[model samples]
Target chain A: MGAVTTPKQDRSRATRQRLLESAVACLAEHGWAGSTVTVVAEHAGVSRGAAQHHFPTREDLFTGAVEYVAEERSAALRALPVQGRTAVVAALVDLYTGPLFRAALQLWVAASNEAQLRPRVTELEARVGRETHRIAVELLRADETRPGVRETVQGLLDMARGLGLANVLTDDTARRRRVVAQWARLLDEALG
Target chain B: MGAVTTPKQDRSRATRQRLLESAVACLAEHGWAGSTVTVVAEHAGVSRGAAQHHFPTREDLFTGAVEYVAEERSAALRALPVQGRTAVVAALVDLYTGPLFRAALQLWVAASNEAQLRPRVTELEARVGRETHRIAVELLRADETRPGVRETVQGLLDMARGLGLANVLTDDTARRRRVVAQWARLLDEALG
Candidate 1:
């Protein structure tokens, strides 16, 4: 028999979603330091008690928010058409150049200061890395790239992540575009 | 005739240096938030009041620390022999694969959260980009490097900064070697 859907389970899921949404907004405006439980609760239109009931602690709330983002991002990434190296690189660039990436960047910066949040942030980052590597491996297979070239491509991806964060903070749009273009060129030169 | 060194000036310079050293050690041991004034003072064998006498606030301390680190790093980078594309890439990798690079990674992760700290980190980061571009322009001198190659190369350097942070945290010797090797290889291919 199929498992029954409990009312409590549904409500719990809603509360979790509320917290995650509230967290993204709060984190964007007030940054990590100002993103307290009370503030997030108010932002979410939920009571402090309800917020705590769901998240338990500020650290838990932040981790949940990041996990929520990563899951959503992972889904989007999975949906991208990874037919060839060019397509794959374009999708990865789009992912980094979008709003979701901005949110992830903000969270990472905030987590850098909070000692309790490091493990969670690091783990989420690792998971993202693994997913990206998997996509890269698949792209390599499709392109018939040598093993050494596949490894080199993964390294470029890592470099792209680091550059993307720096680019997001830049004020010059033209400059940012150029950075992404350079990434594409590097891929074409080394892997394509 | 020589210019006289006032006691106040000497004391100010000494206090500033102590605070920088303490901040470095504190950050190394405990990350960003842990580099509080109380801990810094204790680390430097000075009273809390003495540390405050030099740095009025934590932000000031952090800003001074960033500038001090930037100067030190710039000096080291300047000292490197970066005549050709290969030497340039090798010097860049050597820069990141050392203790100075580790210190930079620490400061970077810490600075990400505090918006006030962002400009300082970004400024130093931009300078690094500009310097790299200068070296690339001088070395490559190739007009065919698409309009924004310099900017992209700079962004890649920033990404290297983040990846280096991830690398240090993972504490994997193989990963570190791989990152540097890939970076070197990519640079060789892109500029060679």
Candidate 2:
């Protein structure tokens, strides 16, 4: 009985994971408008009924996908090699400017006017924000207990997100590189 | 000829201005999905034909609205009272976290997935970005000739935009104030 139930659970989890990844891809490529249940199911090679079974509504699907990607991103951040401040900052910039950020931006815009999606998005953003801040604080070796240190950390995160927004609309790589370098310098000066 | 056409031209300009303002209001309140031409025209108290005559297309309407709002915001920035560094920073934060930023965030998200809208949004953003940077540099009286000075200006703008993004999803007023203050302190130290 245990073996049979475990295999079934594993298959169900795999299907759900595939659906979530497909949802993220749809979001990144097509934005909120194009990320439909039918499309996601097709992309995931799952039946519409199966997708519905996993996610009852579009909001549920989107929220699940966002949380899924955030967890993946957080795990990836934690796995990043311990490097110099410049390298770490560059890595963080790359993460923020990538597809995950794009997907999240789409949701952010949708949630701006959507009453139902707002709470979910806000909660997810706060959770992700805290995790990312934690990782960044560790990487920068900043003393969070200091008076201005936490704000500096938050400021850096804000700056990175803003740079990512610019990158979404324009080829902001050069400017982003320079900004990351400057911020690294500032962080070093403040933390030291 | 000048006198005779002036009144008619003025009327047309007023109608167009009303439509653009309505469009911005629609974007800020309703997000991209609800900001249809019909809704904007209704919001502006203009006929559908008249709205179409003024904007030609939905993209035109949105692009026009964004540009109109950017110009208005730029004017407001230019008119801000010159005060101490903290005051100026506070003003900058207010501008970024205001309705214009919310409206622009919607456009940014839409433009990310919209090929035709991307160029227009990107160009408008660059123009607005430059103007904001110029105003900030003047307000701070920072030496643009220095190597890191320009980056600092860019970084502050980026941080403000990032904070605005956060504010969109969450009630981040307290944290935003602190981040702005910390960044201002850092700027004063570097520029002084």
Question: In terms of TM-score, which candidate is strongest?
Answer: 2
lDDT of 2 at A89: 79
On the 0 to 100 scale, the lDDT of residue A34 in model 2 is 81
- lDDT of every model, 2 decimals: 0.67, 0.89
Model 1, A51: alpha-carbon shift in Å?
Answer: 2.0
lDDT at A169 for candidate 1?
47
DockQ of 2: 0.81
- Model 2, residue B82: distance off in Å is 2.1
Model 1: per-residue Cα lDDT over A82-181, one tens digit each: 4765567656656665556656766675555566887789888889778867766665443435545655666667665665555554554466566656
**Model 2: docking quality category:** high
Give lDDT: candidate 1, residue B141: 45
Deviating ranges (above 4 Å) for candidate 1: A1-9, A82-87, A97-115, A139-145, B1-12, B28-31, B82-87, B94-124, B135-152
